[model samples]
Target: MTAPNRPNAPRWLPLGAAPTTQRRVFCFPHAGASAAVYAPWRGIAGDRLAICPVQPPGRAERFREKAFTSVDALVDELVADIGDQFTGDYAFFGHSMGALVAFEVTRKLRAIGAQPPKHLFVSGRAAPQLPDTRKQLRALPTPQLIAELKVLGGMPDAVINEPELLELFVPLFRADLTVNEAYAHRAEDPLPIPLTAFGGHGDPRADDDELKAWGELTADRFALHTYPGGHFYLEKKAGELIDIFAAELAG
Candidate 1:
């Protein structure tokens, strides 16, 4: 693996001529979100790194396709889609349901003996191994499920108010929640990579201590950062998060 900070040219070269690490960060979105959610990040990231959002089926351009409900199956399909493309230094950032998907995808990459992420950044989720005690709300009636999502935040009031919008949003959310609620965690040795976990101060799902549980999954380095917001804190903390990514990927 290429160290992010390892100079690509001789040290004697002029500083401007020295090549810096330019990594590709694959991002996964929260439940019921499309790859479009990360579109704004390109401008934020600038040229320091590339932001590639993983778009699973059943959303956006893939709206006609069925979404994957099984976490393991989703990981398998994503890895297959990735193939051998991770030959270059890369990283991962995921939030909420996406956080879990990103972590599982990283593990699947390791299983295939493929290139691993230089660093793993996960947000809005607790450690995967933790038993999910949250009530099963995926199968709830549409009104109840949307209500629950409202309590969790992230869904705009406009989306909730429009019956036409709910027709499109509801099924995708059910599939995503099913993915989260049906997941079964299997024990594996900790990964040999740094992991930085992010959380919202007011997020009932993943508090400071819950976020810290991610440390147990990495033997290299572990960090936990909390922001002041609810479950959708990243919507407000994007700048700070990208800034950290820039600094971390530099080395």
Candidate 2:
């Protein structure tokens, strides 16, 4: 079952009614996405891990809220708002732009001496230190932006064809891209936590070497797993990926 709509806690969407569970897995979505993308994970994760999907502003229930344009500001607010959720065992799973946000939040939490995640699962994003090679899509015209999304292959064809949908989607999409593109990684000491990096073998945005570079950010165990697909590989490989997550968390 889906979690109740949390009007107060704007940052989290708890997957079930349980107050807590063995572990909490905070899942962050990619650019132009919302917590709904992770709703399926509620069943996939089972009871061992509570899937808490984050809902950033300017989308879904928070549609009226202004989206964050600065990554640093975003992380600062998230760390502060999350409060006691980090008290027990937890992990972070982020895809694409979300991975960078998760990484920054992890760093901010550690800096404040809060409890750190047992593991960090970063997917579809290169290590933060690597310079972004993708063309800046945030500044593209409406037609070009729509074309780029079509090439990315995650949005429904209906959404692409519907002009009314594009009216709302385009701005949010550009806002999210702007937030990600504006990010500037600040050097810091390597984290002591283990990190598991996931990448698509054919994804140009996150090459093998770039994914492997995640190792340098972790002082403990580091692993990289490549799946067979392009940028949105998780859509097709969710079951396999969730199995790996379950095994790792269980271990």
Candidate 3:
């Protein structure tokens, strides 16, 4: 295989390097999350798979950039930005809104005849075909939005309580939610890639049935795993989750 072109990388931050290994795992974070969210995975992934976390706009170091408000636009920009990084064997792992972004990015890569990931791990999200039944929260007022975030338990209490911090977070959250809510699934033949669907058993946002529906999105193998927590289950199960990813990607 031809080597991927080496250029100034964009939108990707390498957590650690496993130079001996040929495969990489690109992780996309949930809504309002930054690349730091995957810091723990750096150790658990061992020395065989590099953990590269995606840094979306308007978060962390990219706070000066505008966050994407549409999935299509985000995918297009990511594909162009990443360029030749797809030449080698790689996998994608995404959680919540990140799952949708990863899925769509995979599709876009395939659409353009670019290389596809060896595996796709989607967590804390319903299958794309399933209609999102959750009430639209993107348009909710500031206090109401903060309340929803509190219920989701993704944001830290310190961040939630700080008005100055919330001023930065609320817009980023709104932009991400807009992207999530505005996404419209387009019908196509199932992807040939293997898929693993993961969720929280008690996640009100995504249930077992919705996760199982991911099987229909892939033409190859499909598996589902649920942990004992709510929507942000991976936060508590990161080690176990990394074990599963290491095993599957090693295969």
Point to the candidate with the largest lDDT. 3
Candidate 1: the clashing residue pairs are none
TM-score for every candidate vs. truth?
A: 0.90, 0.93, 0.94
RMSD of each: 7.5, 2.9, 2.0
lDDT of 1 at 219: 90
- Candidate 3 has its poorest 10 consecutive residues by lDDT at 12-21
lDDT of 3 by residue, 1-251 (tens): 44443443544553433232366778899999998999878877767577878888889878999999999998888788774666566888999999999999899989999888989999998898989889898999999999988887889988888999999899999999998888889999999999999999888889999999999999999999999889999998988877877788778
Candidate 1: minimum summed lDDT over ten consecutive residues — where? 9-18
Candidate 2, which segments miss by more than 4 Å at Cα? 1-7, 14-18
Order of all candidates by TM-score, from best down to worst? Answer: 3, 2, 1
Q: Kindly state the number of residue pairs that clash in model 3.
A: 0
Tell how far residue 217 is off in model 1, in angstroms.
0.3
Q: Give all candidates' CA lDDT scores.
A: 0.82, 0.82, 0.85
Best by TM-score: 3
Candidate 1 residue lDDT tens string, 142-201 = 889988999999888899999999999899999998898899999999999899999998
User: At residue 101, what lDDT does model 2 achieve?
Assistant: 85
Error of 1 at 244 (Å): 1.1
Clashes of 2: 0
TM-score of candidate 2 against the unseen true structure: 0.93
